[model samples]
Target: MSPTLRSIVCGVLGLTLSAAGSTAAAAATTIAGEAAPACVQYTAGWRYTFVSNGCDTVQQVTVEYRDGTAVPCRTAAPGETVTFPGYGTSGNEVLGVVLCGTTPA
Candidate 1:
């Protein structure tokens, strides 16, 4: 299997096992129609994982808070996975949007 696929699978498995008692399973969502057809987003607890879908371009991830504040996170190369830690605890009401960007490889 390709590195990207492997990474994505591992992330899914990890999330699945971790969220066994939850009503929903965290799944990877891909962003398409871009020049670089790569990027997956998923959140499990305080950890969010983004995976590249084999594009030559690199993927940049940013987290935008509910207060309209955005924080720059790590960048992941094609077929790689980058994880970001969510702020606050599970009991706290933390809302943030994860933005995925692509750059020319």
Candidate 2:
């Protein structure tokens, strides 16, 4: 991903982090970290996962997060694992977006 795109993503992720704070706290996560690919707003808390395809500019990744709950991310492929920790259903919340790619695109 270009530096500009990375920055934009990070900026947006920052906002998402801020917005998720209260919810994270309520869920006992407290927004403790930000996944890398480093440039998007697809962030999650301790008990959450957010993913994105930073390298694929045209490839949009659409992650599914319901009520901010982790969606059993094990199905995530290699590059897909980055931007978010979609390691699978953990009872924790999951939040992220995917666009483009045919599969986890």
For each candidate in turn, the TM-score is 0.37, 0.22
What overall lDDT goes with each candidate model? Answer: 0.47, 0.47
- Candidate 2's displacement at residue 67, Å, is 17
* Candidate 2 structure lDDT: 0.47
RMSD of each: 16.3, 16.3
Candidate 2 per-residue C-alpha lDDT over 18-87 given as tens digits, one digit per residue, 9 for 90 to 100? 8797555433422223333444346666544555444544333444555654322222344454444443
**Model 1 alpha-carbon drift over 4 Å, by segment:** 1-38, 47-56, 90-105
TM-score, prediction 2: 0.22
Clashes of 1: 0
Runs in model 2 lying further than 4 Å from the true structure = 26-105
